[model samples]
Target: MGLRPRMAISDIEVIAPHFKRRLSGVTSTVVQLIPKQLEAGVKISTLGPGLPDDLPKLRYRDLLQCWVRPSSGKKRIWHARRNIEMVAGIFLRDVLRMPMKLVFTSAAQRNHTDFTKAMIRRMDGVIATSGRSGAFLEVPHTVVMHGIDTTLFHPPRTNDDLFSASGLPGKYAIGCSGRIRHQKGTDLFVDAMIALLPHYHDWTAIITGRVTAEHEGFHAELEERIAKAGLTDRIVFLGEVDDVKLWYRRFSLFVAPSRNEGFGLTPLEAMASATATVTSDAGAYAEMNVSGSTGMIVPAGDGDALRNAIEPYLADPGRAKRHGENALAHVTTHFEIGGEVKGVSAVYEATLAGER
Candidate 1:
């Protein structure tokens, strides 16, 4: 069940396809879920590139075996999270006449294009990452929220551990991680830091994420703004690191200031790291956060609202600490990776049972 590919063709109950070669959110989700799903007793295997060698996998040539009935006498479930994967699943099932059922998992909250709508209609079972995403689907689907790996994102040993690791001139470190672009609300986080950091000397801001070529101008302008405010030292940028989960540990407070998102995971990751968050109401953020309990939720794309939500944490470090504790407890109770594996397995079970 650990790292070994399920080589026996008859043993595979589910086939998870990742058609894209680039490392994306979908790729990360597949990489994280498959091992946990296998450990949970789901006979699942991945297909395609960009995945680690350890996980259970199948070669492209092995797809020929899909035509043979599984030993269980049930159609193998083909789980897809992207359009290209869905199309490939359709071809395998319809054109090649494979003994398989197509299952599509959608995380997008927007209305589907005509092509996507047609593709979804052919799915034997569909899963949505959040209720908001489910609302956009014209077909019936199960809402299965994303979960984090708590073992990799646990809290630090001491309250000062965040400052100790960073060695920055502050008692607390505020953090935002993801791609640096307007859609991700990098500018909003910077503006909030510029407005609030001067007043709160104990707190410093850290941004960790890649600044892609297209967003270079946007990144430069934010730097200009921070310099003009003369708070460049307080608002630091650590552009794109591999071990972001460690950076999550180095945060007294986390922020996900996206103007738009598709089931944002940073807030959940932050919560699992025992750091309270101030996230905008984008993607499933409102679903993950309990306002004033675990963390605050501001209106998306509103800089003033974002600033107001963050000011409370700066004004009262003790309250932030309490909220961080609450966040940890909430995520541990409801958003562990095991819970996601179980929910997805339920869908596979029902689909295999011939329930639409």
Candidate 2:
């Protein structure tokens, strides 16, 4: 798509508190090249705690503007608070001094009535990642769905290769990948897995991720439940793998049991990886998942519903494969990297032009 008339897009910066190495290799690479591709004479910069000291510096004049999404803390609640404070400090002090416009990514960070009202008041525009988030903000904003690297995530030509590498033949594998914590609803997933064990003996659940000390007690409880259910052989914990794509390719089905999300990326990744997904109908899953098409959605925290949703796939391999194919098609058409960049760039151009 050509640039809108009279619109001039400028330098773009993404401020992720902690960037994932996997995403940096693909999505970040595309993000870094957007300005050049758009021919917008833009320079991009990233600033974070982990930013390298040896990274090239940009003078004030060379920079067009700064967009900041402050880093969240380890504890979810504390993290939200820290993010609010950081935004206020940046907008009230530094951003206000500059002639450039300010854009924020989240309502929790930009529109919190108690904490972020001042920051919201200062921003030129707010770029929401989902319609639900935009509604929560109750502000003028554009909903831009985050993009995935479709090239990296597209459906494989042959499942034979993936299956051979996985070493678990003729068994249905249900996989979940993300942080192991209360907010993610990992407990609910475990309960669902437990419920499915008696009837589905050939089924296995693969959990991949680490748990923090704050969640150590919860982790122990989960382990105890797995032992009590006698699912030691059925449930495998792979921990955190360096290459998520490998595991994604190996999965027969992908499950996301999150309670809330700004815009869930894992499901999109799973969809791109061509895995049938069963996700909780919470947060952005409602938007990302196409019920009975791409994947099934059960009510959040309902173990029975989760089990029921997943049972069909375990019983029929052909149905599961069809669902996975649909998921890949959906993601490729709607959530690819180029589409996401264009959506975000439109918001930037609109804000700069004072259209919103």
Residue 123 CA displacement from its true place in model 2, Å: 0.8
**Which runs in model 1 stand beyond 4 Å of their true positions?**
1-6, 158-161
Please provide, for model 1 over 1-356, each residue's C-alpha lDDT reduced to its tens digit, 9 standing for 90 to 100.
34674568788889998888866778778877887887888888889998888877899888888899878898999999999999999999999999889899999989999999999999999999999999999998898999888877789866544566677778889999999999999999999999899899989999999898999999999999999999988999999887888888888899999999988888998999889999999999999998999999999999999999999999998888899999999999999999999999989988888776
lDDT for model 2 comes to 0.65
Top candidate on lDDT is 1
TM-score of each: 0.95, 0.79
Candidate 2 positional error at 239, Å? 1.3
Estimate candidate 1's RMSD in Å: 1.8
lDDT of 2 by residue, 138-186 (tens): 5677887677777666666676536545775336678898878887888
**Model 2: ten consecutive residues of lowest lDDT:** 72-81
Cα error, residue 110 of model 2, in Å, equals 12
Q: Between which residue pairs do clashes occur in model 2?
A: 73-79
| True-structure RMSD, every candidate | 1.8, 8.0
lDDT of 1 at 269: 89
